[model samples]
Target: MSIEKHDASVPHTGVGSDLAEEPIGNPGLPAHTWRPTDVDDGAAKRAERQVAAMFVGAMVCSVLFVVVYFTAEIGDNQDVFLGLGASNLGLGLTLGGALLLIGVGVIQWARKLMADHELVEMRHPAKSSEEDVATTVAALSAGAEESGIGRRPLIRNTMIGALGMLGLPAVVALRDLGPTPGDALYSTIWSEGMRVARDVLGTPIKVSDMEIGDLINGQPMAIFEVDEEGEPLVEGVELYVAKSKASVVLVRMEPDEITPGEGRENWSVDGILCYSKICTHVGCPISLYEQQTHHLLCPCHQSTFDLADSARVVFGPAARALPQLPLAVDDEGYLIAQSDFTEPVGPSFWERG
Candidate 1:
């Protein structure tokens, strides 16, 4: 704790200079006191062992976190403890313990085993001289020597092991991101004969229900169908996934104003056309429409699509046209899908080809 104060009257130019200007006199550091571990060989050994134990505990906790991740069930049948899922509880406790033990181990090592000497540096020019750089390097070397990293193999090895083992939790957790979508992104629940219905109300839409200059948010009728027991056929995450891909916008315009793509002459019913609601740029739902221009706009990035002519990207960052769902009329006159989308819907991906 002994501090050497700089003389204010003299200017400091480089390292080893005891000269620097200060606004006031220095309040020197208190007298130095040696720690118990520094004075006693037995205490030093005990402290070293304690730090190594904590690092070893961190390593164990880290391993346990990975084990729990693989063994614990995540859904309905998952084990619960104190109102929390066993999977989550085990993960939190093990990961938290690993971090806590490592932190405590570092604190103990610094406080008890590492050098406890105090240092004081006076203000000097921003740029250091060659001599100052050399001195700094020497000081760093001395610090490494005093830290006992080279001399104490137990603490060093345990610390390295703990740090290395901590990466296991992160590596194993990446499994949760998959299994890859595969062909799921290429299709939806809009197979042939699936009726088109209003999005939230789930009411079937007929060609007569839509007038010229009208735009309606719609989804496949399969989601609204219920079982004989009066329970929803599609519910929960399944319903959400189906709605995300099957969602569409039905627009009605003057048939003469429409310009059908080659081989898509009968894709629309009269003047009414159906296209996926998802934007081609980034899978954002698009509803903003200009009935006068027969253009659909995605609010997310101002991507404009010409619904009058195959829903092609007319503006903004969208790279492709909106996927069209061919329309057909059922026996009851309700709008039904001629078939699933001819192409994949939503944002473009590497496997989209």
Candidate 2:
């Protein structure tokens, strides 16, 4: 509760001489202040109960969150509030409330029950001496004792319950990541009749639209198809997944520069060729094309593929060539996929077998 004024002539053990040479002498700490809970048993008990009550409420909310998760109907016809799904609304509120309660309880515990005394820690070398390590361990033990956690049974148990219950939501939500993608990567939303359209703008491309040495970033029309009101039929996560896997690039080089793969001789139309935009190395979209050399470059890892030679690996980290999409013209003269990619697209994985 008190500290004697230091004799500045004999410098403190760990302090440098420069610190002791300041014009203003050490002011020392102000008088020790005691909180009402620290001096009165009844007030201390009341504060402890209030903190415990908060933790208990957190535990209750966590439990109710689990109950609501299991009971709430999440179908298209399920309950709605203010245009938000009822199940999502309930889960968010309960989880948020529970976390808020635990935070408030911890603040109350520290402010009212934990040690209020202050002590100075001297600056030292980066490497801790053996004596300093022992002192640190002792200080931690003293801090734990001052927090009154051992003496307050109600606070200790409720705080433990609240923290323990908090983990359930995380455990339950891991199920939402869904089952591992199996054979899903082997295919995409690109069907045989699906037409290739420009990315974002969704304008269909034709052989006449592209000139020699031209390359256009494109996506399948299925991802951008609109309903009666012209709103995209595929949207949100489904649209994202479709776009990622079905993305393509249409490139036109001199017909003499093309080197078609075995059985893929007809995969191109005139000088125009279609290839998966996703790099084989790690699935980064490949757009950096050099028309002079007919090479496609992946920026992520500098993986390069030769577009002229069936997108073959030219001079980079990619193990294989980019997958080719067979191209054909619809009656409307728009380029369409003759068939889905013959091989799986994107970076190779263990499940690729």
Highest TM-score: give the candidate number.
Answer: 1
Per-candidate Cα RMSD to the true structure, in Å, reads 4.5, 7.0
Query: Per-residue lDDT tens digits of candidate 1, residues 288-337?
Result: 99989888999999999999999998999999999999999999999999
lDDT of 2 by residue, 1-353 (tens): 11133444533332222244443344553455789988999989899999999999998889888887887789876778788888899899989989999999999999988876545454567899998999889978987898889988899999999999999887777877887687788998888978899998998998889998899999998887889998989999889888999999999988888888899888888889999999999889889988899888899999888899999997888897889999988898889999999899999887665
lDDT of 1 at 298: 93
Positional deviation of residue 331's Cα in model 2 after best superposition, in angstroms: 7.8
Worst 10-residue stretch by lDDT in candidate 2?
10-19
Q: List the pairs of residues colliding in candidate 2.
A: none
Clashing pairs in 1: none
- Total backbone collisions, model 2: 0
Off by over 4 Å in 1: 1-31, 36-46, 69-89, 125-145, 150-153, 171-180
